[model samples]
Target chain A: MLKYQQIASDIERYIEENALQQGDKLPVLEALMARFEVSKSTITKSLDLLEKKGVVYQVRGSGIFVRRHKRKGYISLLSNQGFKKDLEGFQITSKIIEFDVRKPTQEAADNLNISQEEDVYYVKRVRYINGQTLCLEESYYSKSIITFLNKEIVSESIFDYIREGLGLNVGFSDIYLQAGRLNEEEAGYLGLEKGFPKFYVETLFHLTNGQPFDFSKVTYNFEQSQFFIQANGPL
Target chain B: MLKYQQIASDIERYIEENALQQGDKLPVLEALMARFEVSKSTITKSLDLLEKKGVVYQVRGSGIFVRRHKRKGYISLLSNQGFKKDLEGFQITSKIIEFDVRKPTQEAADNLNISQEEDVYYVKRVRYINGQTLCLEESYYSKSIITFLNKEIVSESIFDYIREGLGLNVGFSDIYLQAGRLNEEEAGYLGLEKGFPKFYVETLFHLTNGQPFDFSKVTYNFEQSQFFIQANGPL
Candidate 1:
């Protein structure tokens, strides 16, 4: 990590440890500089980044205070990647519920642009962070493309297998997000009550050749997750 | 709309009107060209754009077919803009539920970067699309900055007022999205059953000068909404 990022992490840790509430003022700039053993400019840069991230705000003469709303477990929607890369300091694990090669459903066949006669590797799993179930994922992969997938690979990150093991670059994905009540089976897997609200995501992963290889439906526990996306203005 | 876009829209309308299903083959390329009275290249371009948008896919020998999943509403995560610009065909309206200037709560004070003693203009409204309630929003604005707001303005687009009325450019916003069940009051207003799952959003808006000014919480009805974000690969 860069020096500024390290300093920011230290400050974030301090805030978390102290359980700082909204509008609670932090230590003075000089104090932060002395405590972190950094120069004024370094402290200023770190604070600038933090402010941009909506962590704290400056009141000119009144000093810096914590913002009311703080983000937790932000999943960047922009990256054609998985949460394993972004989630730091959390132990993530997956339990494979069902993994088999089966005839593609009409929906799966249409999503992957394959015929109904073609077989697909269907995998369903529940993902946990720190032993708490966070998301339930049901995915279908074109067997013709991901021909080498097995139960072992299904137990881990499929994206890693595609990029590292298969040497196929994951290019982009089309994601649709909505809200829904968890069905009985999903509730049982996530340890939630029946009909609890959940965030639902449907994604189609395309390869570098612009051919979609995988389709997935993921349901995230409402209270334990947050999704983030950063957008720029049109040129 | 551009020629290609117009052709794409026409094709989309045809699909909707015909109630096209997954794997349903579209008209042949020559047929589409004849119907649209355009050259092969224009038709190809429109189809390419639609394919990228996950509307349709192609088989090497068969032809184009509709994809299983179609997105209805897409909220661009990257843009620091409003939904009005993106929702072109829909008739959107807002009903003011509560509008008042009151002493800022600690959370609102911190979110807006104002002192506890300062007053904040609070606005609550429900947004409708084609006569259906889609989202309920509660927002707080700093009275010292957005000083000209009224109930009439609150019933319309606040972003329009900030730009056209106050002449202040609405800059970037830090948004947090999560899932939650709607309470009784929100359920009643949105015509959803109590305990229905909904998508919740928390946004903190800043000015071009990097001053935080507005904070809002929007609850979107799960069944009637879908959010889309397109992310480019890292350079």
Candidate 2:
């Protein structure tokens, strides 16, 4: 990275470490220069980089201020880590409705790369944050890959269990993000009217070995979620 | 890539080239084996790879069939290619509502990395598919970088003009996908009711050199659009 780029990132981290809120003032130009031991032009270039990213902005007469609205409200690109990991720091909790090992449906068998005769773990849950319901989720796991599952595991982070306990590497997912409406039963659980708008996300997750292990459908309360994506390149 | 993975991708392309539909049958194992000059085991392995990806499925006693439903109803991962390129083959047209060189707002100046008094190419448009309105788009382009614009260029593709004509590399974007309710004016353009749910996409597009150039706001008609995302890895 260039000197300005490196300094720009350090100041970004400084804003985060200090937990700067929107409209909060950053340190003055002279202070940043003294701290970084850089020239005025370098400091200005660094601040310009941050300004371009909408991380912070300069006021002609007053001072520089934090501008975080553009940075927030995004679902980051690395969402394959699972929502729990993706939305870390939120008070997330899951209520398991059903968990069972049953015969795979033909569709599940194909997605999980297993035979219909084989068993697969089926799980259904309601996800909440701060005791407010947010989503309804259902998933099927390939028994050959996941090996085991219980209420204790389902109540918390299954992605963590898959990565840490099973010692497996998580890979890419093929996902479909659709706009949908809630049915009567779903509306009752979510405290919304029937036909409320929702985001329906279906994913087929693969292990690093390139075999799929899980298929999930999560319907999120649209009002409570803002999906974010960061994209790069024509390639 | 493994031989099977290679074959799996080829079969995926074959499905597209053949324009196969859901539940449509693929070539039999014997035919595939002969077509690729491979053994029956190799052909089956390739099919297994396809099955795991939900590209195709096999019946217990019957033949394999296309499973394009899981594949379609999606926008692809290469959406950075711009929506027109992303949704290729669709009949698309754009109606120019507003286009002019104007002063940037403070927020627009911050996003475009230009001074508030600087001239910017302001564009407002309505995009349609098969004459069905799908989105309302507005953008501000830095005049310093874009250099030129007109009705002809704006009517077709600014992304294509930026790359092929201006010889600049299009870089990544920071995007926030929010579910918003339409106001009266927007609803009129989209033929939806006031308070109709829509996908509000805000993007800051940069050139490969890392300078932000285009700041765009697009409100999509949700019922007519299904946003697709494919995610990969913890990284």
Candidate 3:
């Protein structure tokens, strides 16, 4: 390892051993340089590396302090998989707000390829991780295709029920994400102030037969989480 | 097409014909209902669909209004491609801030898999689309692999020079995104107030030989743009 990397690793170890929390300041730059037997430039480079990793941040005139590592929420845009398997090591729960057969709105009807006269199962849910509400999801499912759905299924992973219980094949999805200020009701459910920035994700899920089955709009608290996606290259 | 969809399409056409600018109020709900000979619910649903599609936004208690369609900038997370092709319709330009070889910081050295003693080509550019500064990019390249770079190359597309001029194969990238407040310098460059929300993206680009070549951090104006990704599913 390079000198600065070695120093950065040592500092990370120190942070761990001392159980430093967010906002806790590290040693002064001169003191760190002396302790590590490095020049001021070397110490600055190490600190810069730490800052880049989001482990520590600088306060300009004050000093370098630890940053709160916000727990990230990941959604694999590449796969039509259930969140149950992806969020391992986290306590995940869902609260079903509404589950009833409702007349499909024009948008939902068009996306689901159903007639406006048809009734779709509308399920609204709030997802939580470790007791903190993180996302509000409003989904419209075609009752004609997804024939087995209830409040119990809605509370759990609906994707699992569709694939395992109903023995159907789950296919791909087309998703669009936008950032916007949360409306009043969304802010209330997520415990955010009105007009707080939120990420709105619109997903259209299809089955193996190439029929759209579900259309969902998920709003996430932008401050608490992020979305991850990977792309392979031909360009 | 559904009845509401037809009405929505007609409304979109009307907006185009009138060349309504952003913040321009649409016709009153009652007027639209009477003109289309549709019920209030139908007109309301059509407007709701438009809002969801991001064509227009509603102001509660006032009326539905035309939303300025913000031109979206696309960065493919799955590919190590340049933005030149993606932003073809817009007038894109770059202002080179700094272009010279510099000793790699520890983070850059590790990401580019280079020795800290070796100098690397460092380039900083403020990218503008249609005369509006949208992103600030700071990129570091391995001198051994790239072997040739200058301000002229930085002003155009560096990826194009790497692939076309150097005859190198561009490969995949590992990207991480976080939300942060703009620092003083960044705010000055983007003309944003300090502490304004910004999207920070860190990218580590690797060649087809699995050797790291480029490390870049792009800070985007949060309120003016959004990042998009599409995923195909097998999982």
Candidate 4:
């Protein structure tokens, strides 16, 4: 592994061993560089990888802190397969679009097990990979479960909020995959021509005991996208 | 349901109940229309829907047939998702840029859990959604499981082949999602600017015994598309 990767792994180990919870502060870059006998550049790279994975964040001058957030889950988990990490070697960037609390739609209520008229926090985002517009993902969560949702939290990963802020153990989930075309609203957001063919992945997360929690759908431009599943052994 | 949908459902049921193997021909269209008391237009729509789903196909005036010699064990199912029905909606087309069988790479072998030297079929496609270069999907399959493959099958859904031809019991799968930037090879296929962003999905399949079977990675042009996942309660 690269020196930076080692630094990242070490930092992660420290976090785990020390039981340093999310949002906890880490040592200054200079201090870490001196202690670990590594250059500041290597440390920066190490931090970048972690931050991109929704692991930590910098506070401008105060120092880097472990991000108390859940990194987004992949659509592959919702299918009968796990994710293959080597597609086009693409890297993803997320932009927090809008976040707020609102009443659940019938569909959202049915999936999340919330009352149809109950208010829920909505987190909407436009995600890009390699600078191309890839998908717009909108997630709804019961306000009762996530009572402190804010723009700052939305700017990060909601998965983090469910796990860190609420101290809920993220568990296994159920998923559905389908293929479809872009709707007018989606096309507009993705900046594609209306009615473009796309792939749809719907995921529902629940506890091990089968309590329904959240639902999300991701539509990929099929004309420019592909799907993969990884499996082991014979049936 | 509409007459076309009814016919489509009936054919789907007939194939399921009678143990009709993959690549098996169905009753003629005239017989179908007569039995269902439907117009040719309705019958055509029914078949078209099935074809769009990769369930069936037509060969010029030679009449329609199920796609023969398809990849088995994995079903390629389709839905409009309330958008247009086919790739035409994207206004872009795809061609098999490359097709062959080769050994799975270290990563690929790790995903499929076979010997690294085992042969796997590889298919590469460049898709255009709405005249814009979208993505290139390069897929790999176990050669033994998928006895044959071709550009025609590549242009259609693989799920149809797996379930209809091979008689494998396909079921739900798991998926992993991420966002990343396009690399050199993907940039070449997408005609995208270097370093553009994209969304990536990696999925793995397993038999009921939790044995891994296949692995795939799909990348999408993030700028022009989005996807969704509609999940259900745990069974």
Q: Model 2 clash pairs?
A: A74-A228, A75-A228
Residue B186 lDDT (model 4): 83
* C-alpha positional error of residue B203 in candidate 4 after TM-score superposition, expressed in Å: 2.4
Model 2 residue runs over 4 Å out of place are A1-70, A84-89, A103-110, A113-118, B1-70
Writing each residue's lDDT as its tens digit, candidate 3 over A1-235 gives: 6899899989988997998875588999999999999999999989966764545766667788775332355644455555654576778888988899988999999778789998789999899877887789999999898886888888877888988899876654556665666799999999987777676778877664456689899888777666554433342
Give the Cα error of residue A190 in candidate 2, in Å: 2.1
The candidate scoring highest on DockQ is 1
Alpha-carbon local distance difference test for all models: 0.79, 0.77, 0.75, 0.60
**C-alpha root-mean-square deviation, each candidate:** 9.8, 10.8, 19.6, 19.3
Q: Candidate 4: lDDT over CA atoms?
A: 0.60
DockQ of every candidate structure: 0.27, 0.25, 0.14, 0.04
Best by lDDT: 1
Q: What would the per-residue lDDT of candidate 3 be over residues B123-209, giving only the tens digit for each residue? A: 999988788887899999999998999888889878889989999866545566656567999999998888776777787776654
TM-score of 1: 0.69
Candidate 3 global CA lDDT score: 0.75
What is the RMSD of candidate 4? 19.3
Question: Model 1: runs farther than 4 Å from truth?
Answer: A1-69, A233-235, B1-69, B73-81
Candidate that beats the other on DockQ, 1 or 3, i.e. the better one: 1
Of candidate 4 chain A, the 10-residue stretch with the lowest lDDT total is A226-235
lDDT of 1: 0.79
TM for every model, in the order presented, reads 0.69, 0.70, 0.65, 0.40
